[model samples]
Target chain A: MESLVNPYVSVDCVLLGFDGEQLNALVVRQSGNNGEDVAGIYKLPGSLINLDENLDEAAQRVLKQFTGLSQVNMLQFKAFGGPDRLKNPEDSVWLVRFYNLNHHIDRIVTIGYTTLLRIDRKMRKLEGGYEAQWMPISELPRLAFDHSAIVDEALKAVRAKATLDVTLLFDLLPNKFTAAQLRNVMEVVLGITLDVKNFHKKLAQMPYVVPLEEKEDGVNHRAARYYKFKKLKNKHI
Target chain B: MESLVNPYVSVDCVLLGFDGEQLNALVVRQSGNNGEDVAGIYKLPGSLINLDENLDEAAQRVLKQFTGLSQVNMLQFKAFGGPDRLKNPEDSVWLVRFYNLNHHIDRIVTIGYTTLLRIDRKMRKLEGGYEAQWMPISELPRLAFDHSAIVDEALKAVRAKATLDVTLLFDLLPNKFTAAQLRNVMEVVLGITLDVKNFHKKLAQMPYVVPLEEKEDGVNHRAARYYKFKKLKNKHI
Candidate 1:
């Protein structure tokens, strides 16, 4: 059968989910390598896109196939097409074996996409004989292909977006979050340490961050007031 | 001879330049179609990448070949890979004739890139038998293929970056510009009008927008004070 996928182009998704603490990325174990050392290696959930699908559609299909999540907003951050992207022999071996390619493939240009998800909210199950897991960004294992660099670029893109759009933070936080939780989201996304007082002062200036009457119920420390991001009628700060 | 360029991947550059007033984009007339109407249609300066070249290298090569300008910073904004990007029949004809390909070409995934330039500073000469011209953004002609959409996306990316980095505005402005010129850059790039007093008040808060001792001369009316962007050791607001 003729291959339905494009041989020279692929999409790699950086599925970053916040676990209410640190940001984590979803990675899948590579399969069908005949028990080689590269068989169990982790890689970003991605593959060569089908000829009939749009790039975004291909990314969405990859995201769903690996994590069983649909309708998630994914941003195309960058395209990795270095001449030596497949310099690592292991990458070429795994690709040829896994894809069952009869012809030699020298290079594949992969587009990098990213999305933020709440870890507790989404139900994730590994599919297609592949094992998947969410590993914290700091402790990520060495990824296959140029995926480590892809992850770093994805993080930079997410941080750049966070600086402009405040609502991106709401995607990672719970429905009602304390000021500390908000600060945590900001710090983790932006990769910076913020003083509590200064952060609160900055947060107070944003009209979209509405304070709720409810407070934390069960906690060891004092119950902190909760805040919810209010949907503004106009452009957000 | 075997084709050196990758048929499946290409690069399109959106070279925007500020002419001390409105922002303009550098576009080139498509050639080599026996003087057909499609041959004269304008498109963003772009072409497919060589098998051995990186994406950035391909974009840089195209930029230099079209405009005779080199070493300008370009940012990869997005990838356009819709299955029907070549639904326009003219596009397929142009591609086949331009590349002299024997096989059927169904799709080409083109990475969109953008860069800001000062029109008065760079000596732009049309190269490679193509007539290149800078058309004001407000008066861009109907472009071939999906280039109109690509230009729009590039403008959006530049505006998004302008909000985060002040240095981006300086790229379009003269070294020493009046306050009105600065405001004009902000308005044109961000696509918004700013009140003179309010905008000046906001500019005052930015420490990097240093005021120069010299004022504008040879003006019909009272000259406005000149200001230059001071490179900060740290981040600029």
Candidate 2:
């Protein structure tokens, strides 16, 4: 199995997307010879990087192919590698010399990646005849490999950032939104609803939020004030 | 490199032990050669598990073999696998079916492990002439694959736990120790010296950390009050 490690390194991406009220996972039911060595499982959409491709390109390509949606953001998580973690052990897969192994199985090493994508609730119908559902983070089934734990870690990160990083709320907004609609997204992600009256007051104070002086339409009676986040490149902290 | 994704799965343990104030990586530098492959420098001891071996057993056996020590404390991080993380796609090292691409390279997946052991610091010499240094975690060099990142993540976990987990400070103390020594380890880990008057008052108050009758030696002009953490089974959380 020492002969099994290869000429390319691959990354697995666990994408998390959110709406106004729910925190969801972007999972695709796996296809191929479902009944072969591996069967009856929905795993992360992962693949090996091309010989000339950088890791980002490989991850983006795999995500697009599996989800049929493009332009989502992805970030790298920790890497995984160890002996006997492979499906087939009798080749060069053990060639992953970085992982120190003592057992007989050839070691497998992988760089885990994550993405926070805007959900195209409608385009999900274009997926490969496989059921793709936005399962709540807590109820994910026994995932293939250590993916369950992977989601656990990624969620911690999302929750942590929800408080400090304001950009995440963009996922929940439907292109044009009222301040009240935007506040709903923040409440869901924060796991606690803030004082709506005070929240509106704070939004009005931020210089970057430009009030359009337009009113939301199709309401039962009086429409609410609408605004857009003045687009500014985030100067990373 | 496509040939490198083995269906077989396994785990790897990256055991980190702390002695008093400094950090140590429990690694065994190995040497072997393939046709044109050069075994370059790397860190940590590792192994693969038998088909019937539980993840915990594999980690324990690997730890005993590498350190001649058993009943060590540890945690599993993640599993890794992506075909072609290695260079040479072939040449068998372990028993699993692995596809190695070239000399000194392979696609591998590994489950990471982190631990805190109070091994006799004098027994630091590697049995096989492999160097095992209790080097400061801050000075780790570029490891093979993404191992450097693995250790980095572990350190982050340790740092995150420093504030709340009482057991984390135990590794730095002897079987019995003074509350002052425990506080010192916390300061080193958090990278900021805490306010002593309140820190001492707080540790004594925690139900889990009972004050010991013992006090420090004459080495200190004023012997500090000693306290010990109540021992428990695997303080992983």
Candidate 3:
């Protein structure tokens, strides 16, 4: 089995995006033997590593191929390996069809890389026929193999980083956003509603996240003050 | 070369311990052909993974072999790989003899795991002939291969975890300790002098780390009150 596979190393990308209202994941629909979409199940964008490239390079390649974007801020979060990780009956069946792995080669040790991207015009303008779909993280179905666990760990990493690095929020938000919009994204990630006044007060204390003198326009109700995050001289304390 | 070598995954353990005052790292001395200790150079305990074992199992195996202890709390921190990681001229020369790698295969990707052990009676009672040494992390000299970078990353993870998990300090200290002692450990780990009054005030707020009715005995000055950490229902918030 070892002789048959090039190298058992693979990379999975948990590409997270912010869509104003909810946090989303870029998952691809699985394809069957006839190249038809398998309708129900989806998986993270991933691929076996080429022997020529390193782990980071392989991760970047997979991210680019799936999202049609380069220079994504991907982080190598963890490596997942277990004897039966790939041999789960359903997962192996898919592997046999898609990857053509021999029955004996039933395990692959995959590195997990995660990145957050804004749901901007380029993301919305993805080419036709691409099998990728933006699924809200709150409503993600069971993913292939151990990818569900990978996404869980990536979310943990992001949440931990958010408290220390303000730039993560900036990357996920629009150039100018109201304080409520900022708090909503954090609430979505944390799965808990924060006290609006307290949350805004905390944001106000930050040297970054500068408030604009102007108020939001084109809204039905009263206008709200806008804010933009400024780059920190040092990202972490 | 691929056919000649086992699966290319390796595990390096950054075994750390605290000896009351300073933080120390477990580094093994590499010996040359004639059984002479290679003068000042040292490395973390590491080995290639067995075909049958997963990454965590491989890490445990290596940690046990080097430390002669079990039930070590090990965490997989990172995976480091590049085309030239193992191809350093001096490092390759040493690997050629020590690991007996096939001359053709010069690169191996390694996963890094870190474990913190209490430097108590058992640790002090190890047999005299062990090649491993507990060198203070601050005073550590340059290590072999890319191990120094691994140690740096492990320290970063530990420091980050310490801020969130007070139980980590319990693992490094005795069953009962003084507030000053606790503050000293945190100071060493963070490399800063914490305000004694403020530090103790914050600790007082935590339900855990309960103050004990006992006090330090036989000290020159007034004895300080001792404290014990209570097990939390859940460690992480």
Say which candidate scores most in lDDT. Answer: 1
Q: Calculate DockQ per candidate and list them.
A: 0.35, 0.06, 0.30
In candidate 3, which residue ranges exceed 4 Å CA deviation? A1-7, A31-40, A89-106, A127-130, A164-167, A196-203, A234-237, B1-7, B31-40, B89-104, B127-130, B196-207, B220-222, B234-237
Predicted candidate 1 versus true structure: per-residue lDDT over B1-237, tens digit per residue: 121122378899998988889899988887654544465689998988786788899888998887777877799999998888889887897877777666567888999999988888443444235667888999998898899999999999888888778676777878899888888889889988889988888889888898889998998999889998887653311
Clashing pairs in 3: none
Q: Fraction of the real A/B interface contacts present in each candidate?
A: 0.40, 0.03, 0.27
Residue by residue across A69-172, what tens digits does model 2's lDDT show? 67666655555544334554223322233122233433334557676655566644534344556665656776655556667766665655556567655655
Which residue pairs overlap in candidate 1's backbone?
A: none
TM-score of 3: 0.85
Order of models, best TM-score first:
1, 3, 2
**Which candidate would rank higher by DockQ, 2 or 3?**
3
How good is the docking of model 1, as DockQ? 0.35
Span of 10 residues, lowest total lDDT, candidate 2 chain A: A92-101
Candidate 3 chain B lowest-lDDT run of ten: B1-10
DockQ of 3: 0.30
Segments of candidate 1 deviating more than 4 angstroms: A1-7, A33-37, A121-129, A197-206, A211-218, A223-226, A233-237, B1-7, B33-37, B121-124, B127-129, B197-206, B213-219, B223-225, B233-237
